[model samples]
Target: MKAIIAKSNIGGVITTPPSKSYTIRALLAAALASGQSRIFNPLVADDTEAAAEVLTQLGAGIKRQTDCWEVTGGNLAPPSSPHQKLNCRQSAATLRFLAPICAALQGTSCITFAPGLARRPMTPLFDIFQQLGVRSELTENSLNIHGTGGQFKSNEVSLPGNISSQFISGILMATPLASEGLTIHLTTPAESKNYLRMTIDCLQRFGINVEYDDNLEEFRVEHQAYQPTDYIVEGDWSSASYFLGMGALSGPVTVTGLNADSFQADRFMLNCLRRMGAEVIINGDSVTVNSSPLRKTDTGLNEAIDLLPSVACLAGVSAGESVITGLDRARLKESDRVTAVADNLKQMGIKVIEESDRLTITGGTPRGAVIDSFDDHRIAMAFAMLAAICGDTVIEGAECVNKTYPDFWEDFQKVGGKVSINE
Candidate 1:
């Protein structure tokens, strides 16, 4: 579906969506724990749903209640009857995180996905799985995984930091369950360290112990079992960043249901926006953002790359020029985010310069133009936020926001954003 945005002003209170990061982690832990676990405020986005479906296929009993989900766990088991296919669609987390778990399961399983996922590089993950005695073959759009069920030897494995960190997190999540504990060594500086921290924190919450020495660039997991517990997923800070951008660019918007101390890296948007002259108030689990004259500054936000799309939107509306650096890893995300931002902003008549890793935006009044989302959720939402400043913008492939925020357009509409879908 396509969407058009008319010029509008935004100022209202909106509750953020549940955190996909927390929801997926809780689902994985619940599926691994021995007893039933309750997850509250679970996300119902495509990615989270993919994780739920994958966990269900892995022998976890899932029951969705009115507002919560209960998952009963046991040994990772493939479908009772043999099945040749497990489709993950376009969820990277489900495909990457579930692969090793499926490999460690009792039977053989084959994982397949949509075309976009099929074309994604999986050689790095395949090499790691090979070290664990798991054999996988990549066909047209499927990965045929044959597990030896042999013991996973604990060894030091070095990973390149340029690619998706989910691969490392996937191996880390499965390591504690391995017969021998596993040790992971980082060959280069890990991009998205905050996401890795979220994984480690979730593992500890499930009663698995992981010891890490960042200075030594090593992580060790002990052979242990997970203890199921009630997990509450916080509201998504990444999703909240869009609204925060709107508030910064437009004015006096309040976003609730987000924790001020979220482990999610996108929470750093508070600081970035503050630096750009947005009035930000953080009170425990709530944040209120008010508009102020934004001035461009030189800031490095490598630790908060997930918020780059929205941050780019913020920078686009700010006064003067802003230089956002330390984003060499942004190209490998769901979309090549750097180019996506540059291309979309350029169409809006914003002066955007894209480098190999950094993006420089010369902020000025944006003129309305047609924008392409590149089928990326963040790109869609980021451009939507621009509607407050840029009048009469049309977003092609606007439905891509359903990947993370199914109700994004509706929520934006609630906050005085005039949007109409072109069916």
Candidate 2:
């Protein structure tokens, strides 16, 4: 879909979508528990739906309610039909978590992927599964795992952490069911450490305990049961970052339903906006970023890599040249966001230099130009915010926001941003 943006200045109060990370984590935890688990404020977006659907296919019962989800889980049965295929649509988390989970279920299962996900990285997790005695028939498009139910050859495994924390999260979720439990040692320093912490936090909410060191290099889990309980997903800092950026570029935009104390990594977005001289007001559970004289500074996105696209938009309109780093891992996301962000910004008459691990965007008012989202949700939303500040612009693949924020277009309009859909 295409989004036509004409009005530059935008402001108003709007609540951001629920956190996709927390929502999926809650769903996976509910699926691992033995009884009914209620999940509140869950984000019912495409990525999360993939997790729910796949978990349901693996024998969990998921009942959707208007306000919450009731899921009965912990009894994973083989599919009634032959060669049950779990289509993990573009959610990397769903694919990673469920693949190891199916292996632990002690049955033969095939996990398939969408076209974009088909090319995602699977190594190390694949090898880790094999080290645990999981036989697999892996191809470019699908993975068929065969393992002895409730059995793992060893109680300890090691894998590099620089690639993704999801691999460790996947194995950790399944270890509770391991006959002897399991210990995981990180072969290298962990990247996206916050995500690992989120996984552990989610596990604790389900009454599962995990032992880990301060550096997060090692974790130990013993045989335990996951206790089902009500879980509430918090608002997403990642999604709110864009609106906050919009407010920083425009003025006085208040985004509600956020926990200021949450450990979500994208909370760094608030700090970054302030560093750029944006006036920020924080109420109990809401944050407002008001427009002010902006200044460019060195921005490190190591901990908040997902904030790259939105932050880069800020860099484009700030006073001086901004050097943004720690985005090398972002290449493996929904799209090649590094190139995509730089390319999209260039279309708007902004000077941007893209590199393997960094981006340098020269600050100036960008002129309106048609931009492409490359079918990435974050890319679409980030550029859409940029379009609001740059004046009349067209964003192709704007519907990609449905991946995480289904009502983004409507919300954009509600916030006083002009948007027209070109059908």
Candidate 3:
């Protein structure tokens, strides 16, 4: 899919979409509980659907409604046969979270994924599984795992923290089912600790508790059962980033339904925009960003890695060169986002200096050019915002936004962005 964008001034009020991370976490927690749990305002995107499908395959009863999903959990049955597969599609969270949970259940289950997810790093989780005496066989795109019948041999394990926060979250979610409490030690300083905070927040709502130190290198989880509870997913700051950037570049835009106190890493977008000299207003659950001449700002993405692409786009048109550091982990996402952002900016006639851990972008009058999205959702959306400013910009793989925001283009139009789609 391709989306051709024309330059335009955008101003409107948009209700933020539900958080994908919170939706999946709530679904998994609900699926682990012993009774029925109702999740309200859950995200209906590709990733969340993948998590729900994987849980259904694991014997959880899920009833989909207009605005709520009722999940009956606590009686997980292993795959009926070795041929019965649990497909997680392209959602990395689904695979990571379910792999550990399946390992603690009885019977054999084969977890399979698309090629994109297959290329992600899973060795850390597999190595930890070995310490827990969970037998597993791996293929290029599938994992054939044998459960310990609900008990891990080891209660303590260690792994690197810089790779992916999902690994830590996966372990924390599954630990409650283990016979003994588990202690997780991180060999390196942890990045993206906000995600772990989100996971802990969701777990606590379902009657589970997690403890960690200030530095977030170690975690302690006691054996407990998940209690069924009603969960309401908050609005996503991640998806709202593009529109926020649009407001900064174009006109006043207000986005509602956001939580002022959210553990989501992307919630830092407001701070980032403020640092860049964009006018940001907060009124209750709504945030409004007004068009302003932005100045150069040096920012670190270690805690909010997902904002790399959008931040880079904003930097391209700022007043001076902007430095974005702590980007080493960004390369390991759905695409090499650092390279993608650099390439796209260069195509638009912007000056960019790319490095392994940082990017230096010089503000300039960007010209419209064809952008390759690399089939990454963030890349597509970020560039789309840039396109509204650049005009005559064509974004390839524009449909990729379905991974997180299915109605992104529609919302773009709602905000007065002029675009034509080609399928």
Candidate 4:
């Protein structure tokens, strides 16, 4: 689908969507728990749906009620009867996290994905799985996993941090079920440490114990079982970043339903915008941001790569050129975000310089152009905000925003932005 966004200044309060990161983890934990688990304020996104389907394939009973999801956890075993192949599409979180859990279950199972995810590198995860005595094979777009129904041996494994942290998080989630537990050692400084923190925090919520030694660079997960509990998913800070950018570009805007102390790395967008001279006020679960003249300065945003797309939008309207660095890891995301942002911005008649790991956006008035989303949700939302400044910007695959925020276009229109969807 394509969408044409007409220019207009943004205003009004927007409630952030439920956190995909937290919802996925909470759903997985509920599936692994021994009893019934209720997940409140769940994120109804494509990725979360993929996770729920995976759990159902692995012998968990899930029922969606009015506003909450009810998950009845059972033994962590693959279906006893013949099962249909699982399709994860392009959800990297589901593929990375569920693959290990599937490998640990008893029975044969296979997972296939669409072109986008099929091409992503899974060799790192394969290596880690091999060390845990799990056998898997990659053929075309399908990954066939056979479980031995045996305990995994604990070992010290070092992983590259520059790729996706989901690799480590997946292994960490499965390690608690190992017979001897597992110790993961990072070979390099881990980027997106905040995400790992979220993973650990979610594991603890489900009754798993994980110990981190920062000085030693080791994360140890003790062998334990997950207990069923009610999990409440908070609002997504990543989604809130777009509205914050809108406020930074036009006028005051308040985003409700986000926690002030979210573990999401994108929450740091508040700090980055403040550092760039935007007036940001946080109250409990809401944040109010007002437009102010921004100053360009070299800012360290390594921990907040998820906010890069929205940050690029804000930077386009800043008074001076802004340099965003330490984002080499962004290439492995849904799209080569670094290149996508630069390419999309340039199409909108903005000057942007791209590097292997950095983006230098020279702030100036934007002009309308047809922009490609690269089939990424964040890309679609980011350019939508840019349209507010550029006027008549057309976004191809704007429906991709349904991956995270299905109501994005409607919410944007409610905030005084006009969008025409072409099916």
Candidate 1 lands at a TM-score of 0.96
| Candidate models: Cα lDDT each | 0.83, 0.88, 0.92, 0.84
Write model 1 residue lDDT over 184-213, tens digit each, in one string: 888887777888888988888888888998
Tens digit per residue, CA lDDT, model 4, 1-423: 999888887888989999999999898888889999999999998988988887887778889988899999858676565557787877889889888777666767788787888667888888887777777889988888886553665356678775577888888887766667778888887877888889988998888988997743579987788889888999999998998888888868899999888789898888888878999988888899998887775665678888888888788878898999888777877899999999998887779999998999998878898999999999999888889866888899888998899999988987888888999
Ranking by TM-score: 3, 2, 4, 1
The segments of candidate 1 whose C-alpha lies over 4 angstroms from its true place after superposition are 80-84
Task: Kindly report which residue stretches of model 2 are placed more than 4 angstroms away from their true locations once superposed.
Answer: none
Model 3 Cα RMSD, 1 decimal: 1.0
User: Model 3: residues >4 Å from true position, as ranges?
Assistant: none
Worst 10 residues of 3 by lDDT: 75-84
Clashes of each: 0, 1, 0, 0
Alpha-carbon deviation at 381 in model 2, angstroms: 0.3
lDDT of 2 by residue, 190-249 (tens): 888898999999999999999999999999999899999999999999999989998988
- Specify the highest-lDDT model's number: 3
Clashing pairs in 2: 106-149
